[model samples]
Target: MAQAATITIGSKVRVLRVRDRIPADLVEALKADPTGTVTGFRTVDGQGIGLEVDLGAGKGAWFFDDEVTLA
Candidate 1:
């Protein structure tokens, strides 16, 4: 399997797909514009890593590592 790209704060990324449920507006926004900058990281379930992406216009959301890729 291909390994995911390494990401860090300020890195540009694009949403690949959402694995968890989120607000409808966020989902729509992602579908319309999937690219964003990595703002930070979060611990998910103590085993997974979640990325905080700034979608611009004050819009932001967290996505699992597998849900995004380097842009």
Candidate 2:
């Protein structure tokens, strides 16, 4: 398995891939510009890491560390 990328707040990143069940409004925006800046970090019970990816156009989403790369 590929090692997970390390992400930090304000880190620049590009989407490597995405899950299928994303919100409808974000689909085109995500595809148009996969690059985004990490705005915050999230965790489930302080466990797995989830990232706050901020793309322009009021678009942002939480992505797994494996779904993005440091840019």
Candidate 3:
């Protein structure tokens, strides 16, 4: 798991896994390339934290903290 203290905006990270259902296109995109840059953070379940990652070529997705690690 990535510690919130260690991750910040613009950090590089890699998708470890998806914990929730997402669009097929995004899933395929992640399969093709799981590494991306952290764009920002979002609230999940009104408590947990989610990371917004830019997968390049206009691709981006939000992932749970545990689903990603510093790359």
All candidates: TM-score: 0.88, 0.81, 0.90
Which residue pairs clash within candidate 2?
none
> Which ten residues in a row are the worst by lDDT in model 1?
1-10
Q: What local lDDT does model 2 show for residue 44?
A: 43
Global lDDT of each candidate: 0.86, 0.80, 0.91
The most accurate candidate by lDDT is 3
Candidate rank order under TM-score = 3, 1, 2
User: In model 2, how large is the Cα lDDT of residue 7?
Assistant: 60
Q: Write the per-residue lDDT of candidate 3 for residues 39-63, one digit (tens) a residue.
A: 9999989988899999998899899
Which residue pairs clash within candidate 3? Answer: none
lDDT of 1 by residue, 1-71 (tens): 13234688999999999977899989888888999999998888987778899998788999888888899
The count of residue-pair clashes in candidate 2 stands at 0
RMSD of each: 2.2, 2.7, 1.4
lDDT of 2 by residue, 1-71 (tens): 13244566888999888865888788899778899999987784466677888998899998877788888
